[model samples]
Target: MCQTRTVGEFAVSAGDYSAVVVSQGAGLREVRHAGRLLTESPPVRPDEKPPLSAGLVLAPWPNRTADGRFVFDGVEHHLDITEKDRNNANHGFVRTVEWSLYDATERSVTLGVPIGRHPGWPFDLTLVVDYTVDAATGLTVTSTVTNSGDVRAPFALGFHTFVRAGDAPVDDCTLTLSAAKTLPLDPERQLPQGDPVPVDDTDGDFRSGRALAGVWLDTPFTDFADTDGRHVTTLTDPDGRATELWTDTGFRWAQVFTADPDHDQGFPGRGRAVAVEPMTAPPNALASGDDLIVLEPGQTWSGEWGLRHRDSAA
Candidate 1:
């Protein structure tokens, strides 16, 4: 029997926008604009994992930690190395876990999950994610995290969602990012190397918007433009139809991934999508203490991110 039948599913609709939120990890299952799919998340099956962490929330920590080990305060803590080949702890372990639907309505839903003290991560936390759709603003996600443990906790966040403009393949689309720098990764571990490098005049540059045709990208970008205190990225079709993702002051990084079919790593729907992830910190943050967020007991941290769409005609 398919276990998906037992999982909770919630939907919100307003105007031309509709979204499906799943119970597992409070991940988003799908989003559509005027009956057209806007994201890459397909309906999840009972025994299957989401394709490319689609519509999933990466929390507690984002990206990977080398060797799954980090020295916090004065103690050495070890996390499970989920990426065996790279010997690193990949995205946080909540995607497969279930979250409780605390509230739901026709245009919004709120899901909550509790994190207990575990061997790898010893901090206790209670996270609530609220997904809402607007008639004019499209979809907005607000996440709140409260430290429930007696001691302080280290935390970071990332959101995984791929956007598409119409049915065209990603190679025909243009990507415009409001970032000035790119984090270079080590060839072997694929982890961030030194400080970020300027993207201006380089292949990494996409300031004025660039066609993704032959560009291979799997990079973390920062130095985001603070226009009106918001950072934005857009993916557009040749005809001008577009989808825009915006992050608030809390997000300091954005990782862009092009799902190439030729890559050795298997990716569902490869060569068809591009993921523009809003992240609070970059890879190996847990070990570097760079841009990491630390919360004391009873403290709460919150942030927001969202997406909007525009038609070719207007």
Candidate 2:
């Protein structure tokens, strides 16, 4: 009689870590460490949409496609514009759609969906988002995309999650990112406007870690100095407790945004909150063909990004 829950919540736990992966968009809903919140999640009614894309999967292409138009493989296509104010196609088709439950285990849950929602995106691809969390290691999310179509398909992947360090005010938290440069964005459309800039004196220069009090950004940082296989970023509260987010080589870019409470659009928090997003490519990858992953028929692209909660707050 009643419609299905907007996003079915699948709960998984192991040791001191627990996570809830929703069926909608195969997105993450909640993640906790030792009963303390590790990621920021807004309260939602069963019929409500997930706010601010807090834990949605960004795929096919991340960010926006200007004018919802692009030419690829000598073919011209126009996507259905989702961001009318900017006249662009924002994110992709996966966020608000329902995903099939692929598998579930004590510590992990996998959800999947086939992409090709619009006539503009005519290639068929399957996506599997696997989420795993444990007390010893926190949470690890692996997104595997397979091309199941006759022709090659362009693709990229990203995950949006807001993190906090033990209930600390976001303004007092310090961020350290393992990035060497920042891509400038157009104020009007939030699209790439110029070449990447060095992080030296810019707000992007959080290499040594800096207070986020005065910085307001929705910028992409690239040129990761990943000495090891993993690129890392850290958000530390004033008292020294921190959360570490890391991405594997498949993910070469990260976007950091400062969400304001004065605006209080969707996110449910008192003060400023930081969204550290793991992205395979920067914005407008679909249009620029920059760092886009091309998956031939039967080919797949696998990438991982995760968070580790340090319990020093105890």
Candidate 3:
């Protein structure tokens, strides 16, 4: 029998706020405010992996890159087909790898990983993720990527955090997105196949705020309507308790999923949580050359996003 040893875990706190960041993918294990849980943090055994992405720091490429292959500078590269069923390279490479603690304080911690030239992704880059919390601001996550390779690297970034407001069922909550349009996905591959469609006159129109009840969503929305360079998506319960996930202008897209319990691969607390993933680009951006971040040698790019609780129920 073989065993996998635990990597590392860091818990940061400030006043009544706290967060747990695990080394494996530098994922956020837990987040709470004033001793009240704001996100679902499932218990993982020493040898087990965090299931359903949970609170993952996606990098290099956020979503899928069809067939795990892309062309750059007239050269074609093939990535490992991680999602065999879909024949795509899902997420990026760093999620399953351990990151080293770069820095830490009483209320914040930073993790860094050096992505060497490897199979599929043949670019040398350093990714750093900083998690910080304050007495009044909740948890703030910043992800930065620096290109160390001789050539430019095609990249994209995103964050996966399953959010919840107290104990309310996700279906009973209301969702408000600042998106003017959304991409319609291909049912088989779940990839964006055509130009984005306007959210007007459709079930996708969340501009006026809509009850998430009975509305199934595993969709990506863009054309963000931000105010003062900040974009926000909020989920509020019937009692008015709400959780807001905001991002900088760099994060132009967001994918919202209503973890359905009836699905074949349901999340841990299915039907009770929603994952509002802040993404830099839509799925298969590598192939489409759509909004993909190209990091030239010695260049760095960074973005910030975070979760804040509004306790209107109190």
lDDT (10s digit) by residue, model 3, range 1-314: 11112447778887787888888888888788777667777788522467788888787888888888899888899988888988988888888888988888888889999988767778999999999988888888988899999998988988888887667777788988989999989878788889899999999999878997777788999998877788988888888878888899999999888777666546775545678899999999988899999999999999999888887753
Can you tell me which runs of candidate 1 are displaced by over 4 Å? Answer: 1-6, 265-270, 312-314
For candidate 1, write residues 179-224 as lDDT tens digits: 9999999867879899999998899889999999877778999999
- Total backbone collisions, model 1: 0
Question: Model 1, residue 245: what's the lDDT?
Answer: 87
- Residue pairs in candidate 2 whose N, alpha carbon or C atoms collide under 3 angstroms: none
How would you order the candidates by TM-score, starting with the best?
A: 1, 3, 2
Reference-based lDDT, residue 284, model 3? 94
Off by over 4 Å in 3: 1-7
* Model 2's TM-score against the true structure: 0.94
Encode model 2's per-residue lDDT on 1-314: one tens digit a residue. 11223457778888888887788777777788787677886677523556778888887887888988877898888888999999999889898888887887878888899996576999899999989987688899988999999998899888888877767878888998979999999988999998889998865788999998867888999998875899988888877878888899888888898888665552564557788888898998888888999999999889888888774563
What does candidate 1 score in Cα RMSD to the true structure?
2.8
Pairwise lDDT winner, candidates 1 and 3? 1
TM-score of each predicted structure versus truth: 0.95, 0.94, 0.94
Could you give the candidate ranking by lDDT, starting with the highest? 1, 3, 2
